[model samples]
Target chain A: MEKTWIANLLPQDEYREKRLLYFIAEAVFILGVSLFLYLMVESFIVEMDMPGDRMALLCIGFLITYTTLRSTLTGIEYPDVASEKRYQKEKRLRIYSTIHFWIIFLFISILFKGIPSNLEETFDIGGSATFAAIFFFILNYLSLKKSYKKNKDLLDD
Target chain B: MSLNNDRKIRNRIAVLRAEWNLSQKQLAEELGVSRQTIHSLEKNKYNPSLKLAFEISLFFGVALQEVFQYEEEEA
Candidate 1:
């Protein structure tokens, strides 16, 4: 019988190995992004001595969205055409829940931080960038949870 | 668990799949799994779930007992 490429893409391991690989990959990705952001912010501070970065915030927002979506989508598997409906349900639930948490957490953080002293100017740029990181961090948790849920659902069904 | 009589078991799977006039893709889709699963099953590299076993039986128009049989092989 001919092999479909999808099967090769599927995570093939017991739960422990799968979880370990997932967390490791997540940590690596987060570390890479954090390092890049640290360098960029440091360079901006050193060179321009700017109070905030509008471009960087926009770039970070897009990067976080793209990475979160890509990683989350890659891990999903449907048993058959009949399962697509259920897959869609699970996908929606996972994504919406993530978004909800992101928004809530952002507001909570802003309230706790009591707005930066340079709110008007900084918010026009750096504020959103900070929010983007928060969004991605929350998304990381959501994606990890979704991955585990996918495995559990498969075993259950 | 390992195959009790590996060679004959391998031969049985090939025979069954061929007799049904089903392609690997078709069988995999019918089984609600990826094509690699069918290949692995054919190669005896992976075991099927009970649900998968029932589906195979239904697909081949055979009882599970007919599709898979245990033959004790002496060392």
Candidate 2:
């Protein structure tokens, strides 16, 4: 006999709907954490006598990181391609897109922000952006790998 | 369902399920897959893996060729 709790939690007949609901719940949780982080950053900037614009930049960075992490963790099944190929394509697309976006962002920043006018500030922005990009890319790769491994049996190929 | 392309892998799963007096949900449970997967297979929108194909043939006590046929266009 199937376990009652498991049946109730994941009714086999409603598997697709349940999966969608789980994804939404996860997205909400991620959003909540990001909001909390934004508040903490706001308080930190105020305490440090930093500029208000810094807070906005940090929040944007945090949102980008949160979005990348969420996509990595969600494991939403791709409907088009088979399993392994789909995961590989997803991983490649994610890394490439993140890198492309960051490059554009850096160019825009350098153009508008005048290259920070100092060696120290230039290093700070460049180093932080590079670190964040690397961190996001790695997170995406590992998460996709894990999801692919876990769902191998469920997928078509 | 109407045959769309000569390159498609044709399956008789719906007919077999009817003969066995099984619903899509029951067949999916027996095959250890989602009901949606069974529906997709019946509609020929998704191809089953080799293991799944073998399992289906085994479950129905029929040859694999009897359950699945690959149709090709004539020259």
Candidate 3:
């Protein structure tokens, strides 16, 4: 059914190749910019003799929150991957990850002789670490639920 | 196509789309897939699942064999 056209789009292979090149260019640009920003901030902090702990925490927290929000709302897929395929793959990956995390956590708890109830029974992990772990787990679970909800329609498609 | 996959699939989607004067975007919308997927199919870079393969041939008003060719890898 080949028809002549006065004007036409690029061939499919060329289109995919060009799209991949664009993605690479963008990714490289983003990485370079972020690195530059990080270096500038770090140099400033070092010159000011500022304690890096709080800054590191803030940066990590901000990145985590930003990524979680994005993934939860938008769903994460590669540029060329289909949303429905991504939904299916992500669902399987999440399940596997959760199971692996729990298995490791259980192993750690058993090694530590049951989970600590209070600071006195620290089990070598301080209160903050435990709290952070629980918080992270809850956030992860919530994000997965949101992702599933956002991508559920992809299944029908 | 997967890097390690031995099966080779080639399809005449580009031919059909060109014959129909359909753009990648148009075929993608008609097939309920992304333009990138159509591109991949045309390039033989990705193998469509049986369901998708059938849908594509059906959309082109062609038989499955007319649309898709399967080749075995040399041992």
lDDT of 3 by residue, A21-131 (tens): 444455556656775787787787555444689757665666555544554444322223335666567556666665666566656765767766776766445443455
lDDT of candidates 1 onward, in order? 0.56, 0.68, 0.62
What residue pairs clash in candidate 3, if any at all?
Answer: A1-B19, A2-B19, B1-B45, B1-B46
- Tens-digit lDDT track for model 2 on A1-157? 1446655644343334345545556656776787687678778755445577985777666666655455456443332223566777887898897798678767776777777878887987787678767876777667667556645634422
The residue-by-residue lDDT of candidate 2 on B21-57, one tens digit each, is 9877678879887655676688786787787899899
Compose the digit string of candidate 1's lDDT tens values, residues A1-157: 1256644644542222233345546655876797687679778766544345764675576665554465555443222222445556655665676567656666776676665568584464455646665665466556555654554443311
The list of candidate 3 runs beyond 4 A from truth reads: A1-35, A38-46, A49-69, A77-133, A155-157, B1-75
Candidate 1, residues B47-68: lDDT per residue as tens digits? 6656667778887888888876
The CA lDDT at A26 in model 2 is 62
DockQ of 3: 0.06
TM-score for each predicted model, relative to the true structure = 0.34, 0.40, 0.34
TM-score of chain B of each: 0.72, 0.87, 0.85
Query: Which 10-residue window of candidate 1 chain B scores lowest in summed lDDT?
Result: B3-12
lDDT of 1 at A39: 76
Better model by DockQ: candidate 2 vs candidate 3 = 3
